[model samples]
Target: MGTLNLSFQIQTLYMSPSSPSFNTFTISLTTNRKKSNCSRFSLSMGNPNDTHTKLVPGAAGFLLQDVPHFTDYLDHLPIVVHKESARGVHFRRAGPRQKVYFKSDDVNACIVTCGGLCPGLNTVIREIVCGLYHMYGVRKVLGIDGGYRGFYAKNTITLTPKFVDDIHKRGGTILGTSRGGHDSVKIVDRIQDRGINQVYIIGGDGTHKGAAVIFEEIRRRGLKVAVAGIPKTIDNDIPVIDKSFGFDTVVEEAQRAIKAAHVESESMGNGIGLVKLMGRYCGFIAMYATLASRDVDCCLIPESPFYLEGKGGLYEYIGKRLKQNGHMVIVIAEGAGQELLSKSLQSVDQQDASGNKLLQDVGLWISHKIKEHFAKKRMPINLKYIDPTYMIRAIPSIASDNVYCTLLAHGAVHGAMAGYTGFTVGPVNGRHAYIPFNRIIEKQNKVVITDRMWARLLSSTNQPSFLKPRDIAEAKKEKYPANGILDGKIVKTMSMN
Candidate 1:
């Protein structure tokens, strides 16, 4: 018996708006070992809780040398995390021998999809199954039949590599999907009953929230099972991730609808084409689609409110565009224009199983208004309203999405195998990493109207501002007079003025 001595040097580079700081430290370890034995061990940079520690390039590259080099056969591998910080954005990458926390051959893994169907659900599911079977040599993969409910409902189907080999050629999940199954305790009970060690939940924000609860319940029960999710928002509204699965397909599909609308509108005398995209709380789909398809004349999103009837409002803008060019194309998100048309925030007597409010149909509402606005005119106005949400979401994903979904699935599986639970495999700066569930659900991602993307969209479209800057200033003045309001008297005087 002898001893082995290992020494490593760590160099950290801090980047900021002011300057860059470079620091280096050396770490060494010595342990007694048999001369004939090879150590099967792993190296960690620093304490996981130390958010300030930054692992520089040299250290990461050195650590890569010690890991297995099986990634040579893979076409695309995750890049390395060069810099780490807490203040702003961070980059993440994977090493050759990333940790596989669940290393047993009999590990039971369940895959479930929740919420609506997207373009690449089948592709992700198939990749997950194949990765588990071939890479990790795990043969016990189960597909939950109907999302979260399938956990407690005892509806599952055994999945194998052969079963999912050609699934990527199809759309939607073979296991099916639904919403409103947030029974954490019951789901954990089902996991324990089946002896499942890893669960992959594929869905949007709501599904992630449910996953967080399920993870918490597993922890409360003192269980070791891991729960991971792949961000499935077709709207691309998940925060921190550069893009979610199916978003590229969504933008591509939405372009077709926009092209059709443009052709139909340009063919008529005073034509207008209205398109409503799927974005409930965010407008990434509509915004990106408008930018991609340059035929759009006006773009309205939930992040930017529009007026129907005032100076420089939606109605006036459409009328002006018709007079100028004889045709107009307007792209509006499904969640857009709700505040302007609806008197209250209440849903229109419709609720889903998840208890979410069914959004009012903004497309139909705007369509009727356009007709009424031009009804009395002698010159005929032809307005086409298109809602292609289901059609777009049902189709197959493009090449870009296929690659992105594959990477997301791989990242999730790696995280789950490495004992990383309660996190979603999302991208930061176009690299896949395990993003915590709380960060995903803490805040909603929305289009910033002030950003360059929105500015480019507005300039490219050349549409009238639905609500102008001066109008916003005047509204603020009307609410609060120049002279401070002493009481009701000041309000009355301001009204008189």
Candidate 2:
């Protein structure tokens, strides 16, 4: 393998109204690569001279200092100071640029939503359409219906400010969505045929992978199309971002189910309430919901392993809690304790159309197990199980998520217009930045059991950690290395906040 060297300089100008002066800060980033399986850690762009003229209108007062230059970037590892090696990873800051590559009159943009339904999907779609029309004087915008297949199969819907005016008030996506319909060749061909120069893809991990393929194909064909992705996942699993779009809404909506479970359990004699939320590989939903509810006695997630039959296990903890409180509420992620289910049921693993594993209904399985365990002890228990998996994801976004979706959509639009390609837009460290597709899709972010947030959850619920000595050792190894390097790549510490 050969080393890939990249260098960029950022020029930031600070101006004060009273002082009538400005200060400039120039930061340079140079990275030296030795060995890595990941793709190039830089945002791809079109011709350097493509963007030479300022096209955005009605911003004459602050355009000179407000617009970010092409060289501006955000350091990926801001806290890490590698004194020995003059190498650092950085991402281009996402915002309006002084110069734009695509002329407003010549630009034709399209947006598509793929994967499962999520809260605020329509909010993102509406913002993209409105942002382009109102920000830049672009009039031609198309909505790709039915995901990737829509690029070639279905008819396109023309989007306007009036058409998507109140879409944010509605749930789900107006463009429609599907899974496992990616065909990069056909999609790019249709894009070329239709003269669409900008593409915005909104989806989760699998959908982002498909977007990466489409971007590569466009780049290979020497097309001028810019591909941008807005990460969307109800599970909050996408890495390198503060949180996914629908995550807050899902967490908020999940509280309704938890509240109902608490009410049902508290009303019945020797009552037990079990609520399952949406989390396939991560336990953020379950953990956060439990902490917010403050009524749960026990919480189970995939990151922490628990056995039912052993001492200090789930069964013993439940018995003790019920005996003390007379009623108890338990929360479990969808992916929690899958190995136990698999071994007990001896079922074969299956996958969905999007290559995701079809998870067994752990909510029902565990409820049955708890009933059997109490029955053997000649104990009477009334257990209420609530699975709000679909309900939480299908509802409209709350106030916070609606504002967040608007910012994300605008960031993506700015990047695409500035000729940045193969990137996703999201808040990194609370500031918006354009991240390469390879970075966000490299790994799924999971809830860190050893983090302070998990500790807080345990403290609030008074539940056992359900962790063994070996599990602790494994978690330590899984965290970011002390040297700020992992597998020959610089990585940020995992954060649950």
Candidate 3:
């Protein structure tokens, strides 16, 4: 790398003895002026008109320390970049920049939220509105009510900084939310009618899938519109992101459920506390809460399946704990161990509006089982079953979540104005970047059961490995009776003693 010389004029507060009338001093760099790379520069400070003023000794220390460097952008990249085939190497820095593709006065933006309510939803809305208007001079921002249906349903309110300034203090989306209504054609027609050039869709994977469809429809009509998403998976199941907006808040809120369960178990004589968390397909929320609370005795997640009635099963675990400690706390995700309790998905055929199969009631199901087993044994047991899924989802975000939502919104606005579409603002190795919807929804993110986080959680709870290494082999070798439950091999092991 070569060097470049640049000079700076500084207005110093101190007055020089020889030139008391001169308030400004000129600092000139003595280096190769034609070169591009200037890692270090030497400064020569003196009055402009007076050649008699000599350069101060060691004056370049403060001047050189304040100057910007050429390799500053490299620090933004990940510490360790996983090289795939080592072809077409490049660098991409994230954050808002001045250059944009859209004209500030002519730009029209639309904001829509979908799926369930989550913490930091209002904070994200406030930041996007503030960023578009204050940062990009965008004035015609509209907030869509409900989810994808808001596009064609003609439910919108004009968004202004004054209107959204106090929304971050409250929970839920100011524009409201809903599920389903992912009609791409109708939504695109509405977007065109309103002259909306940029659309910010905030929701989970299903909502992002809908946004992708809408973006495709816009392209099919040969229109120049931008569609971006802010991943709002409260369960933290979205792939490629370090953590979703509401995850930290959910972990903080789920701690209350654990606390309550612990208190109830201690109050009763030989009590068992069972708390259920929200995680339809993954168990990030449950796992994080268990790890954070530090009061839980056992935890079950969707990634790791467990038996209900077999040897060394959940019931036996609870019984052993009650005999040992007289009080126990158990945390289970709402989606965990469902196949062992509910009928096959094919046989039940129940689904919500988002086409997701309704999860079986794991919380109540386990409570009943624990009660029945203890009742059969003629043992007096008090088991508290608490489900705080909706309560945690409806609360406002904490300080950390508010900051995260602000950054995600800023990244979304920058990417949209830069003409990037069909992508969501997600973290790439802990730095914010635009990840395409296809890459994000390629496969649902789940907690790695073998990872260090799980190991740490197991050590904290001191629970036996319900899933032994030989359990898979033993499961495959075992035969199933035709009359018993046949959801999977795990269900076959749930035979009653």
Candidate 4:
């Protein structure tokens, strides 16, 4: 085991609009290239057998070994962070309060929770308000109602200690959020006139570009305003942070749902279940669930190809399940094989609350296909459930991620007080963290998803993440050998792959 190195800086290279073509621009971040540098975060776990333990970062997480760069590593390392507007602004914080002038402390800072809600949002917001007023001694903490729309329509009000006193354990943000708000010159002017020097935005990646627009516009007006982004998405797709706050909650929730499906799938004499998770373009939530809950016969993700025919991935899984336990549960990410494999995406009509195209239920669609495939033989008893709504996003409380959220929130407050602007706080090593407030408007993060994660996923595929026990229980007597998907195939994969 050796020292851990996992810090990076964001640098953006391009941007494009959503049309018949790509909607989001590719981004990047620079991390210390240490293929040979071992991450000591995981090595602290003294022994592999301990079930109840905590592994801190920079401990004994890795072992020293000669390393070589992969052929496609550069392709995956394209984007980490990007701020289209803030890269061009500069404003010193107003000095400490004087009778004739207001200090940065006097300048108000407010946070708005917007767009479709995700897990762990309240935890982030709670830390913001509590850390801001109590720790920093800044008085006003505004909670804008209904997201970006609230900001545009001037539907703002002040938040207080009483407002965030007990919000950490809650599900949704007290300020609420709307995806409809537009960032405009008029909006930025209003924010400046109101004496708000800093604005905290907590939302998915969609809201980040808008935040950039406001910061840029404010700086253009020669205002000393700073804006910070807190990433929130159940998909856990954001690239900069080692992992977003809501990811744990979403995975926990998905694990529970998969367990239920597994139980039912196994109870039947002949059965099959397909559990679909909510993931649009990113497969983090889906991949994490598969890793956490090993109950599924086969796991499918959008990042990688899934084969349902012949004797490969999907077909073999069902055949083995029927031979051993007679029933099996399958876990899938909604975005996995979307337009090509998901009926939800292929449906002629779909829409969400705000009238956006509905990301249909991938679970049901997969289940139908399995049923159709096996029904001709009269051998399958299939049941399916889509973990839609708030199942994964409404988790109660988890210590590991709760601690991470607390640190991020508290760190953001510190950043504000220290006059750190246009930067974000996120975990670096498992324990240590970093800040990315640059010297000036600069390139955004260059964060591209790494295939290392995908490789780990493939190697672990046959081993069956935490699911070997249930898989063994349901697996039929191995008169035939498909050594790949059974026991001993699983080696320890305790880290967040």
lDDT of 2 by residue, 199-245 (tens): 99999999999998998888677777889999999899998777999
Instruction: Please write out the lDDT profile of model 4 over residues 356-383, one tens digit for every residue.
Output: 4656566666777777777775765666
Instruction: Tell me how many residue pairs clash in candidate 1.
Output: 2
| Shift of residue 168 alpha carbon in model 4, Å | 1.4
The residue-by-residue lDDT of candidate 1 on 1-497, one tens digit each, is: 55555554544444444676554545444444433212122223233453223332433222221111111111123322312223233333431234455665857899999999899999999888987887788899999998888877766899999898888888788999888967888888888888898899998888988888887777666676778888888788877676888998989999999999999999998999999999987899998999899899999898777777768777778888899999989999998977756673454556788656678888998898778867854557999998998899998888998998888888777766765566787666555555667667766677776567888888999976565787455544532101100000000011110
Error of 2 at 42 (Å): 15
* Candidate 1 similarity to native, TM-score: 0.80
How accurate locally, in lDDT, is each candidate? 0.72, 0.78, 0.73, 0.55
Q: Estimate each model's TM-score.
A: 0.80, 0.82, 0.77, 0.66
User: Which window of 10 residues has the lowest lDDT sum in candidate 4?
Assistant: 481-490
Q: Which stretches of candidate 4 lie over 4 Å from their true place?
A: 1-105, 342-358, 386-389, 430-497
Model 3, residue 497: what's the lDDT? Answer: 17
Q: List model 3 lDDT by residue over 1-497, tens digit each.
A: 43444344433222223443213434444433333222222222233443112232223212110111111111122111112221111112346644566778988999999998999999999999999999989999999988788887777899999999889988888999999988888888898898888899999888888887886677567676878889998889886566889899999999998999999999999988899999988999988899899999999998888886778777788888889999999999999988877652333658888878887788898888789888998988999999998999898899999999999999888877765566687665455655656656756778777667888999999887688677556545543211100010000111111
Q: How many clashes (backbone N, Cα, C below 3 Å) per candidate? A: 2, 0, 1, 35
Stronger candidate by TM-score (1 vs 2): 2
Backbone clashes in model 2 = 0
Judge candidate 4 against the unseen true structure and give its global Cα lDDT, from 0 to 1.
Answer: 0.55
Best by lDDT: 2
